[model samples]
Target chain A: MSEDFYIVVIAVLLPLTAGMLVAQRNPYHALVIRGIVGAVAALVYALFGAADVALTEALVGTMLSITLYAIAVRSSMSLRLGLLAAAPCDPDEPTPEEPPLAQPLLKALRRALSRHYLRLEIVPYASPEALQFALEKKEIHATCIAVTEALTPATAQSAASAPYHLSVRLPRLLEIVQNGVPPTLASVSLYRSRQMTTANLSDSPDARHNIWENQP
Target chain B: MNGILIAMTLALLIPIYEAWQDEDIWQTMLAFASIATKTSIMILVVSVLRDDWMIGLVGVLILSVGNASLMLLAHVLRRMNEL
Candidate 1:
């Protein structure tokens, strides 16, 4: 009788705690708490000589629910992107209130990927060589570097070409570049974060361009 | 029986307090697992006292499969976090 009483006490206490845990705001913890409650309920049934019930509870309640909960949590988070750009901002264009280093493509990313919480990190690479090395090593998600003119305003319109040429490494960014968004849209301050990468509308890219452009 | 009950109560309290205070994904899952284990044990005890094989069988099921889901979910969460 005493043993039975103790089992009963344990049974009650377990669910009570499970219930409390379930009440938490975090779904992750709640899912785990539900598993605990399920296990305890199964235990209570087994103590009462109902192995069949216990078996079903063990099979259904504890395992399946936790996995489902995990999938749900996994599906809900945002994507992470690494960008590197070095494009000259067209002085004639009106500047926006974004950080000084914000490139046109960066602004485009903020607009395009706004629905999901996009964690766009600007990885700094010293030269195009270093940038390419980082991208090859999978350090940066994508990279953009100045193709034609360096940051020398002294040689400005004199030896300048008619159109600007940029190159993009990642597929998702191709759409923003193809939209003909000029390199002039610069808001991100260099002092605000770090350096930048700019790759856009460059025609001389390799085979990777054809496949990624069509990925959609 | 009473001692077991006390132990279970303490077990429950830890999860409840931890869940309330900590927001970590790992700790939360662990707490839930602990609660599920204790509950299944209680069910097994109940099935024995009732002397009903059907009831006992239910306990068997829970003992066997109850924690599987939580484990699976934990694995998924861990993988997703890696991304």
Candidate 2:
């Protein structure tokens, strides 16, 4: 047979054989057969000086087909459940406000006193100096600032003699103050006990102690 | 097999159209016919041997890739010859 005849024959037969082997439920054997055919075809093409055609056949004929068959087999056996459960859910409803346990110390004081005193408010001032001024002027009863703010020299000096008390840290205080309720009991217990003076106070007294004791 | 027959018929018709228009594109059309004929024959043989539909489906993919490569090679050759 002519070199062209042989090349044409192999090209036609290899894929047919591989597809048949796959249909017979033996992809591993098919893969081996396909690989050998691909390598032989590549060698034959190289000898005949048809390098480009050989390369394409080797990739698409053997490698790609084998990989695809492997993936199909694996997928058939163990289909992924992740894709089925990937749909998004509707957003949850907004919760209503409760009391001191649900709100921040500052917000709790504002809400608790707001009924008796009409214009009671809790504003989050960036500068502790402003918060100190408000506290001194009795404009705001309590303030909630970050632990980092309390560490500043000016804040420390001002808070030393002032009637102002360092409320629990924002994250810990958030637990008690969530859903727009003030944490007055937690703050009062925290301030009155004075057992621990660090800025890392938790929303609950127990949680605050846990934070202090386990300073991670 | 169906896709290959369709492509081969199209390939055969292209040369006739080029010949009718007196266009210089008949040679290119002839090259397409050669590759399409070979692919069509291969598809027919595989479809008969297997007695399955998937063989015809795979024949479509193979024919597409084969014809595209042949066209690219012809284009490159034409450019080289022109140069």
Give the winner by DockQ.
1
- RMSD (Cα, Å) for all candidates, in order, is 12.8, 24.7
Per-prediction TM-score: 0.48, 0.21
Off by over 4 Å in 2: A1-216, B1-36
lDDT per residue, candidate 1, A161-202, as tens digits?
423333344555555444434445421111112233334213
| Reference-based lDDT, residue A101, model 2 | 25
lDDT of 1 by residue, B1-83 (tens): 46655666576667656655676767776666665665655555555655656665555555456555665776777775554
Retained true contacts (fraction), each candidate? 0.94, 0.00
Off by over 4 Å in 1: A1-22, A41-57, A80-216, B1-7
Two-chain DockQ for each candidate model: 0.47, 0.02
User: How do the residues A1-216 of candidate 2 rate in per-residue lDDT, one tens digit apiece?
Assistant: 442353454445445434534543233333334443444344344334454565566457645664566445333322010000111222341221121222344455445433332223223332344444434444443454433345346554544543333432224333333333422233221222123333433323332121112322
> Which 10 residues in a row give candidate 2 chain B its minimum summed lDDT?
B15-24
For model 2, state the Cα shift of residue A40 in Å: 12
Estimate every model's Cα lDDT from 0 to 1. 0.51, 0.39
